[model samples]
Target: MKFISWNVNGLRAVVKKDFAEIFQKLDADFFCIQETKMQEGQLKLDLPGYRQYFNYAERKGYSGTAIFAKDEPLTVSYGIQAPEFDHEGRAITLEYPNFYLVTSYVPNSGAKLKRLDFRMGWDKAFHAYLNQLDSHKPVILCGDLNVAHHEIDLKNPQSNHHNAGFTDEERQSFTKLLDQGFMDTFRHFYPDKEDIYSWWSYRFHSRDRNAGWRIDYFVTSKRLADHISDSKILTDIFGSDHCPVELLTNTL
Candidate 1:
């Protein structure tokens, strides 16, 4: 099976670009996107042969997520089994016969780490939620997790050390998740591969210079690691600040 994840940044905006063309080009079995920033029925999407599922934030045009899959899931869930965090529409889980596919747009720690505390809480809750799913079956989690977990995951690690996405707290939380039995699929396949990133800053010609962070990911239960066949960062694709990240697996 093949899965693709992208943070469209804003679905309303990207659809005006090349979203339709790119979506057709990838043609993934499961296409998950984060930061959709649109409410239900807010945008009309005509994706032939794909079942589209959306979770809208209570606040209009804010944080949201959606998943487009060729197969309709046995069950679909909107949140990570939490009510407070459900307001943002940050997570959507689809239960297939073999696994649970979760797409999440983790809350970004704002400037000066203004939302750091809330982000930490989210990490804790989400970790437990994933573990609960893993107990039943392997889980595939994807989206812009909003953290550069390692120095190698970002370009300006030294300078970004204190930044929201690269802060010690966020990085450590990511580590905790991994230590708890999830594998970062990209790094699992290409640990030493450098300069390939998913999300780039529009400022400072970051994308031009390939200065970006590998915050978007496709992670799974450790036992599913052996089934992973290929993982890629599609830097050539464009529509949002983030390019699509992909995963191919035999066990899916």
Candidate 2:
């Protein structure tokens, strides 16, 4: 099975910019999206052979998530089961007989780290949510987790060490999450691959210079490591600041 995750930034906007073409071309079994930035009844997509599930934020035009899957899930759930953090529509989980697929648009810490405290709380809640799901079955987690786990994950790491996504607090939280029986699939496959990233800043010609961060990911339960065949950053295809990250598995 093939899974793809992309932070489109805004679903409505991306639809006007080659999103249809890109979606058709990828043809993934499961396509997860982050930062949909739209509320209910805002846009309707015509996608045949795929079941669409959306968790829209209570606030219009803000954070949201969706998943389009070729196969119907046994059950679908929204949010991380924490009331305070569920308002943003940042998470969606699809439960299958053998595994659960979860995607999230993790909250950013903000310009001057104003929301750093909230982000830290979210990290703990989200990690606990994943562990709970994993206790039932293996998990296939993806989307824009909003952190560059290591120096190798982003360009100009030295200069951006204290930035929102590169902050020590954020990085350590991610590390703790992984330590709890999860695997960052991309690094598992390419431990030393350098200069590759999934997201770029719109300013300063960041994408052109390849000065970007590998914030999007396909993380899975450590037990599912052998089932994963490949994990890749689809840097060549773009309709948004963040590119799609893919996971290919042997019929998981």
Candidate 3:
């Protein structure tokens, strides 16, 4: 099966950018999106052969997530474990026959690190939530996790040391997640690859220079490591500052 994840940045805006055409071409069995930045009734996608699910933020024009799958899931859930965190609509999980597919647009720590404490609290709760899911079945977690897990995951790591997303504390939270039994499928295959990234800064021609952060990911439970046939970062696709990341697996 094939799965694709993209932080569209704004679903309404990307529709005009022909995101639908690219989505048709990718033809993933399952597709997930983040940072939709819109609420219900603002936009609609008529994707045939797919059951669509969306979780919109309580506030208008803000963080949100959605999932489209050819096969309907047994159950679908929105947001995280905490009611307070659920207000922003940053997550969605689809419970399928064999596994749970989770797509998230993790809260950013903010430019001044003002939100760092909140984000750290989120990481702890999020990890615990994933662990609970792992106990039931394998998990395919994908989307803009909002953290560059290591120096290898980004360019100019030294310069970004104190940056919100690249800060040591955020990176260590990601490490703790992996240490708890999740595998970052992309790095598992292309550990040495560099300068390849998903989210680029809107300033200074960052995308053109490839000065970006690898905040997007396709991760799975360690037990499903061997099932990851391929993981890809589609740098060519354009719409948002972020591009799509894909995962292909026969076991899905």
**Model number with the top TM-score:** 2
TM-score of 2: 0.99
RMSD of each: 0.8, 0.6, 0.8
Question: Worst 10-residue stretch by lDDT in candidate 1?
Answer: 78-87
Select the stronger candidate by lDDT from 1 and 3. Answer: 1
lDDT string for model 1 (206-251, tens) is 9999999999999999999878898899999998999999999995
Report the number of the highest-lDDT candidate.
Answer: 2
What lDDT does candidate 1 reach at residue 119?
A: 93
Error of 1 at 179 (Å): 1.0
| Position 235, candidate 2: lDDT | 96
CA lDDT, candidate 2, residue 34: 97
lDDT of 3 at 30: 89
- Candidate 2, pairs of clashing residues: none
Count of backbone clashes, every candidate in sequence:
0, 0, 0
Clashes of 1: 0
Comparing 1 and 2 by lDDT, which wins?
2
Q: How many backbone clashes can be found in candidate 2?
A: 0
lDDT of 3 at 136: 98
Kindly report which residue stretches of model 3 are placed more than 4 angstroms away from their true locations once superposed.
none
